[model samples]
Target: MFICPYCARNFYRAPKFRAVSHIRFLNASPNSPAIDVYLNDRLMFRNLLYKYFSDYVTIPSGTYHIKVFPSGNTVNPLIDKSLFIPPEKIFTLAAINEYPNMDLLSIEDVRHPKIPDKAFIRFGHLSPEAPTLNVVLPNGNTLFSNVSYKQITPYIPVDPGTYTIEARSSSSDERILYVPNIRLRGDRFYTIYAVGNLSKPPELQVLIPLDGNSYIGS
Candidate 1:
């Protein structure tokens, strides 16, 4: 904090802060083998298995080319996507669909919260072969309705606690996936991602993960 001698004016370089974005990867392709994720040809996630999420990583904000492949192989990549990352955003890039027919689904996670005492959660439907669904409680109370494949709902605020959540077919009201003991802490954000097939092995399941905005600092 020094004033210029000649001009008698205060002039201090505040600081140089590079803009950045936070990102993580989620493997939701039930039939796919453990995978590798690349950003601009550089490996970001290695051997990420189904329903698993990588820890968040920070990067300079800009456009990036993303590719996903079976672990240890770069040839014949499974996915190729072009994405633009704005500064200070948090995201999860989910690898979805069965093997040999997969795509990347980018999910924007929560940022700052307007409510401090409430927890927030969203439903992300990633099952390629499932029907339009309703996110509900065990007692037939619906939270998100008519969500189809690759559809992600907006954040819903609720009391901070562990609870049972369900996914049911929107038409028949029959239960599809039962998620138990999902714990939501106050001031945090979460996404309950429904993945896999409704009629086959790797049967329907949900992966609930805390969003990066809950802890990652800008």
Candidate 2:
């Protein structure tokens, strides 16, 4: 069920549930506070903290004005942008970077007609102050190479299993952090997001969230 932001009416989807699109919000800003997300002046999500993802929401396809403000303060918006949504599409919109220089990143979630036997995953660099980094496997093979802040890598398929993925300095091969024993199932999509600050508290960490393309409308 969803309330139309434009009409302020509560309604359920009928036969054409897939006729609408889906979207989820991700907060990736390292030094930012909890935020309020408004679409066309209607609050859609509130108090979304850093490094967290909101549940998927169904919305009719159209252009929308996205206004992001610090929680409880609507006087000034950190970001005001117009985004278009086509029917039957799913997207993850992420807020990246610190205030005054933040950006909205739209990552499309493509629903495959047939699910593969292997798991599909991608990596993102969201640490604002981290140097160019590499996502490497235990064998030292880099899954993603030299990714800078705000960069998102293409998805790759891997065998379903538990593994420790590491973030290393690209030039020095110095280990930054490691995420251990991520159990991924077959026929799913995921994004391994590296966020937070390298120089301060809230130190760098990874976020592995099952993507909507894997289970939405199933």
Report every candidate's CA lDDT.
0.80, 0.80
Error of 1 at 88 (Å): 1.1
Give candidate 1 regions above 4 Å deviation: 1-17
Residue 110, candidate 1: Cα error in Å is 2.8
Candidate 2 Cα lDDT to native: 0.80
lDDT, residue 59, model 1? 79
**True lDDT of residue 176, candidate 2:** 87
lDDT of 2 by residue, 1-218 (tens): 10111111222342564468888888888778999999899898889988777777888888989999999989779889999989888888999886657789888877765356799888888788788998989988788899887788888888899877888999898988888888888988888888888889678888887878777766
Q: Which 10-residue span in candidate 1 carries the lowest summed lDDT?
A: 1-10
Write down the TM-score of every candidate.
0.88, 0.87
